[model samples]
Target chain A: MKNLTIPEEELMLPGHTACLGCGATLAMRYALKALGKNTIVTIPACCWAVIPGVYPARTLEVPLLYTAFEVTGAAISGIKNALEATGNDDINVLGFAGDGGTADIGIQSLSGAVERGENVFYIMYDNEAYMNTGVQRSSSTPKGAWTTTTQVGKVRDWKKEKKKNMVEIMVAHNIPYAATASIAFPEDLIKKLEKGKNIKGPKFYHIYATCPTGWRISPSKTVEIARLAVESKVFPLYEVDHGVYNITYMPKKNVSVKEYMLPQGRFRHLTEDEIKEIQSEVDKDWNLLLEKEKWTQSLNKVQ
Target chain B: MKKMLTGNYASAYGAKVSKVKVVSAYPITPQTTIVEKIAEFIANGEFDGKYIRVESEHSAMASCIAAENTGVRTFTATSSHGLALMHEMLHWASGARLPIVMSVVNRSLGPPWSIWSDQQDTISQRDTGWMQIYTENNQEVLDSIIMAYRIAENEIVMLPAMVIEDAFILSHTMEPVDIPDQADVDEFLPDYNPKFKLDVSEPMGFGSLIMPEGPFMEFKYKGHESMNNALKIIDETDILFKKKFGRSYGGTVETYKLDNAKYALVMMGSTASTGKEVVDKMRDEGYEVGLLRIRSFRPFPKDKLRNYLSNMKSIGVFDRSYTFGYGGAVFSEVRNTMYGKNIPIKGYIGGLGGRDVTMNLIEKIFLDVVNMSEKGQDKDYEWVGLNGDKRWSQ
Candidate 1:
């Protein structure tokens, strides 16, 4: 018998309204397995706001609070402080927000919470764009991607800007722990959450959650596409501990960025030249992460 | 015990005596001292609660809403633009039925930047479903906080409340206030033990998405019912607070020598103090005038306004905040309450942006109402002390 790495208890019930093979749903399921039942989750205006089945029929086994679209950080801070005030500091306060809720409209509140060193876990589930509002372009949307707002017409109106670096933004706040994980790697994702539980201050996780409907990919290919994202170095799996970076998973086999972009229909209109441009950007980012890991490790040794 | 406390300190003492478990707030002028005094209390070990120093007023209200959801009482204070920033979460707090109480120091909203006393800040938030109490002096500012929590936390009327004090008239002015003992306040307003909270043992989702076919409108209808329930509960709580502390605020509407007057003045906030003084001087001169002060602006004492103003020959409503396209916010509501009545009700817009509503202005308003009644003339409203000639003389 093989040793099971994931917990068996399912805090997210089976009857949620998530679409078939929604990567954000699986990301939540694995996060709950790591956080356990003693956690209170605060969700803002994101897909999970509606995914947590309608009133009188909730999906999460742990207590959940739905707040306004941009107040997830403040809400979680309130929940944690209130719990401490009541002499019950053992309960974990978790803020689960979508990328649009984190990197765009919610950035100020998230930055404030991290700067205050709030004792909470903030998870930014990156579906790349506003999937709940029908695939509008968000600041987290990658370049050369087609969205409702960033249309691919004759003039090529796809998103032209790079995706916002949320993990680096969290790191700049000097948070205790900040990591990037994906739905494809449940073990690495769960390990980061469990490690964050033992830390005393704010811990942030930027999870690459794929959107099958928005990306125009087959529903069953959600996790596979997410795995290709990491393998192509488009979304690396790494964690920063006290300003020191460590890449948790490196691709054993070289995978081109074209392999990750070819399957998703959002990038179908991109020309070879545009894909090459994105590929070079991804390589540059991956090399920078490697240098950060090496340079910060040396700094730690000198200390 | 007696203490010369500013309205801001009174707000802090109110929260302290109520044993509020959480204090989350940001600083804005006039309202800054309230949170500063609370921070001072926390620093001196006098207040045994957690003060979450939020970065902005939107976060302040957001934090208070979530803190209250954890089944603990929470307090926050803001003024002017800070309150404007919190407008969205004010609705969120009441919609979730969190029963959070906030101190709103009423100040003028700015385009030209004025941080003075006016009802515009709290008046603009009248429809946010927060029960707003416009306090006249420092004592009522403190007392209303205790009563507001009791009314808002009632089982049938779960809502948020705002204890409003005029920017500098009350917020910065010091007056003797009776600070209640903690033991007595604990008896008057017990611990907030909500039936449903974010508890791990008994997990449940709050404010989840409801489809059109679900009870979405029903939830809003329930909010209306709860607000209606709050009216009666507010009166009951005021009476109970009086029994415990030996003072009462005359329930939604407070009247002064209004029984036998042919013409009367209707107003709110600190301007009503000047109105009372004007009423006394006019009565001595045999003008048959009195005063009516509106304390609670939401659950707006409609029946009480009708009951008090129906017999008067004419009425004057003094509003510090204008309703743009209309005469005055309170005047519109008061006129609507007196529908089909033949009384010549006139609105007087005055004392805006912290300009003083002096005894002369109040007397002038009274005489104008009296002259309009004598001639059976009706005008919608007039702006007092405009200084139009000096500002725009060609």
Candidate 2:
């Protein structure tokens, strides 16, 4: 028998209301499988809020707590602390929020929880835009993405700002474990979550979730696009463990940014010159991450 | 044991005795000391609970809701701006049917920035499905918290509660409070064991989305029914607490000298203390005046209020918070309660923004109600104790 890397248990059932090929739904499935049934997930107002069927019917097998849009961090902290108070400290408290809820409105509460060193997992599923609210521009929306609020029209006013680095934000709080994962790699995503489940204190994961409807791509292309994001270095797969950085995976072949951006309609309007600029920016960021890993490892060796 | 404790410390000690398992709070003026004292108790190993020093009041209330959802007693405290910030979660707590208790140190809201006593902070949250109890002194502040948990955690009344203390007047003022014994409190107010909770062994979803055809309205109606059901529970808890500790702040509404009185003065919170003294003075002078203090505001005690004010020729409802377009918040509700009683209920707006509700002001209100009972109807309401040239006497 082959060694199974991913768990077989179906914690997130099939009757969800997620859009076809929704990467966020798959991310949740992998997360629940990794954390097992002894988990309580507190979801803020996001795609998952509706994905789990309305009252009387639910998709996740684990206990779920739905909180207000900006209060996921606080809710998880409360649950974890209360569980500890009751002498039942083995259960996992998970906070799952979308990009808009995390990178913008919920940042203060999330930062507070991380700084307080609450024992929980805060996973932010990034779909680039506010997919649940119909592709409105969020802080996590990448540069030059054509969201509803950031239209690529007569004046070429796409998203002018760069994507917010959520993992970096968690790392800035000096969290015990902070990592970036993609829906395409379930084994890697599940591994990080299972590892974080053992370590005490706050662990944050920034998962790349593709939205076919919001990005104007085919429903079947969700995992493919997510793979492209990681392979082309638009979103790197790396973990920062207590100031020590380790890149989890490196692409076997050098994939260009043009290959990643060409598929989705959100970035189809990017001119040749704009594509070149994005390529250079991605290369620069990847190199900075490399230097950080090398320098931190050298410092660790000396100590 | 009797201890000289501020209302804030009284609140902390109340939670300590109640054996609250989780306390999440933020630091706001007049409310900071309550959590600070709780922190001290936790540091000294006096209180066995988990304290989350949250970043903001919104998070504080949110954490309280989550903790209570896990089927444990939870508490929090905040003043004006912090209470306002926690407005959304206040509704969330009650809507989720989590019996979370909080101490709201009532202070005036800003735009003018005052940190003094007023009912506006808690008054604004009247419709948020929370059982609000106004306390007169440090003793009531402590006792109400212990009572609030019992009443709120009742099987029929699964609602959150606010034990409101006037900022500076009660929150900062020191008074001798008899702290109940831990064994006595444990017997009186039992541990919170929720019927349904967020548990790993019993997996269920809470606060999920309900479609329009679903039970959203039904859930809200259940909350309303639970609030009305809490009136009986509040009285029962008060009686039980009195049996255990030999102290009780007359359930819902406390009355003084209302028997065979021609006119009545209505009030809430600390101002009622002044009203009590004024009632005594008027009684000695052979004036037919009495004082009716509303202890529970959310479950308005409508029937009890109407029963007390039925025989009075006229009634004066004093409010520290106004409704802007109309009279006071309590005045409107009192009038609604006595809709066709033919009693001339006049509104007296006073003590706003920490302006003192002095004995003279209470005397003025009683005199006005008495004078109005004899003379014909005049203005429906007037702002008492204003600092302008012309006084309310005119």
Predicted complexes: DockQ each: 0.88, 0.90
Q: Residues A78-137, candidate 1, lDDT per residue (tens digit)? A: 999999998999999999999999999898888888999999999999999999999999
Per-residue lDDT for B1-394 in model 1, tens only?
9999999999999999889999999999989899999999999999989999888999999999999998899999999899999999999998999899999999999988998988889899988989988888899999999999999999998999999899889899999999998889889998999999999999988999888986988888898899888878888888888888999987688899899998989999988887888888888899899899999888788888889899999998889998788799988888889988888998988788988788887888888889888887657887787777332111
Chain A agreement with the truth for model 2, given as TM-score: 0.99
Which segments of candidate 1 are over 4 A away from where they belong?
B389-394
Docking class of 1: high
What tier of docking accuracy does candidate 2 attain? high
TM-score (all chains, Cα) for each model: 0.98, 0.99
